[model samples]
Target: KFTITDGRIARIETDTSAGDAVRLGPALPGLANVQSHAFQGAMAGLAETRGDTGDTFWTWREVMYRFLERLDPDMAQAIAAMGQVEMLEGGFTRVGEFH
Candidate 1:
């Protein structure tokens, strides 16, 4: 259980007697998404084509750099917001963004 005050977290307490305290559906708050490259999510699955050379990690990294170069502030913010919303919808309460 958690307590909120003044729009901030105030306390958390565990009690065995409060059966309703336990969430049974779509529960969040305990979930975490570590190693999250949120901006990369926008470019997911776009680095799988074989070029003159094979799709090596080096090639992928170059592609990623190109992608980054094309990112404007608004696009970056929109993509990041999208990632955060997806994480929250997927039940993640915390995330570590690597951008």
Candidate 2:
């Protein structure tokens, strides 16, 4: 909880009875995934395979590019939303998506 005064932060307090407080319910403290390729989150299960030459970074890149080719702006937005939701559920409140 907090008591603001004249548009500046004033008394800061933790209140058990705060009406709008979000209860974490045994969850760990939120963490940040500092290097997230959030777009990959959407294509997670689809790219966990090896190519004929065996998997490499180049192979993964190709798969990611293919995923992008089929993704329009709206689809990308939805996918990003899904990633954000997953991150939050996994106790990550902040992320830096590389895509």
Candidate 3:
């Protein structure tokens, strides 16, 4: 059993009766994203095209460089915020960002 206070887990114990406890189904620990380029999330689906060279990692690197050249601090923060929201919705409780 567990007790929540202020939207956080306050206590956890086993072999106790659940008295007036809310059942939220079987709970799984939230996952952590160990490696994330949050800024690159803003380019989702924008680099999937097959170029004349047939889409190599070099091509993608070039695209990313161009994107980064135009990204300012505010834009990076906004993209990171959006990525964080997406990560939470996707069941990530923590993130280790690469940028």
Q: Which candidate is the best by TM-score?
A: 3
Tell me which residue pairs clash in candidate 3.
Answer: none
Least accurate 10 contiguous residues by lDDT in model 2 = 21-30
| Residue range 1-99, candidate 2, lDDT tens digits | 655579444676775567875554552445999888888877888768675777788888888899899989999899889989988888788898885
Count backbone clashes in candidate 3.
0
**What lDDT does candidate 3 reach at residue 64?**
94
lDDT of 2 at 2: 53
Candidate 1, residues 38-89, lDDT tens digits: the string is 8888998778667766668888999999999999999999999999999887
Please give the clash total of every predicted structure, in order. Answer: 0, 0, 0
Q: What is the TM-score of each candidate against the true structure?
A: 0.68, 0.65, 0.82
Query: Which pairs of residues clash in candidate 2, taking residues 3 or more apart in a chain or in different chains?
Result: none
- Write model 3 residue lDDT over 2-92, tens digit each, in one string: 7878966788889888888889887667899999788888887879878787788988999999989999999888999999999999989
Clashing pairs in 1: none
What's the alpha carbon RMSD for model 2?
Answer: 6.6
Tell me how candidate 3 scores on lDDT: 0.87
Root-mean-square deviation of candidate 1: 4.3
